[model samples]
Target: MSFCSWFKEEEYRNHFEPGLYVCVECEYELFSSQAKYEHHTPWPAFTKTVHKDSVSKVPEEGRPGALKVSCGKCGNGLGHEFLKDGPDGKMSRF
Candidate 1:
């Protein structure tokens, strides 16, 4: 998916209020703002989900280790995530 289509370029990006990010299509709780971080990318990046099963990851074809993320509650396409080493010297989902 394109970056513009996957993200909401609104108050959520610059704002840092602690809360949950819900799906636009289904209003399903996806991730918490607490785990949200800046990856120096144009899109909002999150390091964690609200629950272990909040989002489902499907392996992307022709892309090793890159998974497409979607809302587990409603199957709405959210974005893509990867398991990468965080800047804090720990492993995280980004």
Candidate 2:
């Protein structure tokens, strides 16, 4: 199956407990539940990503508040995330 298809499946969507997934663009091994799926938007988003180097921040485009992130290697838009107050009283981006 295609890499995007694998990630889009309902079984894998938002399910990070088992810790399985590889960065499609870089083929990097990512085994952390730190990444999660949020339905706030269309594409998948993680509460915490792998690392700054693993992804690239895309400048706001189109709309006034269009924050986006994309794969460094392929330039495929991963998703957008925003910082908000977490339950722990700490600011988090998800």
Candidate 3:
């Protein structure tokens, strides 16, 4: 199985239900599946965080004018955030 599938399966087996996601190390609740959607990207995508303090967006290194999302609690690099139009035709940062 693909790495994504394996990771998702482990999440499922661990009773990580929809609308909830936590950091592996700190157990800091991060993204909500409510904001999650298929973006056809290699990794999982979410429209927003469950709370504003859940993550911190920092300027990416060696990538001028780019942003990277990191875990607020443990400072883990979650992913990058993109400012673009969402599926709902609204401005979104994901």
List pairs with backbone clashes in candidate 1. none
lDDT of 1 at 22: 84
lDDT of candidates 1 onward, in order: 0.65, 0.47, 0.60
Model 2: per-residue Cα lDDT over 1-94, one tens digit each? 0012325454455554756455666675432455554443333445454655555654466644345656655676555434332223333342
- TM-score of every prediction relative to native: 0.74, 0.52, 0.67
Worst 10 residues of 3 by lDDT: 1-10
Pairs in steric clash, model 3: none
Give the higher-TM-score candidate: 2 or 3: 3
Name the candidate, 1 or 3, with the larger lDDT value.
1
Cα lDDT tens digits for candidate 3, 3-93: 1332343233233257588777788988776766655445565667777788887777887645677788898766665544344645355
Order of quality (TM-score): 1, 3, 2
Highest lDDT: give the candidate number: 1
Task: Show where candidate 2 strays beyond 4 Å.
Answer: 1-11, 29-31, 37-43, 82-94
Structural RMSD, model 3: 5.7
Deviation from native of the Cα of residue 61 in model 2, angstroms: 1.5
Better candidate by lDDT, 1 or 2: 1
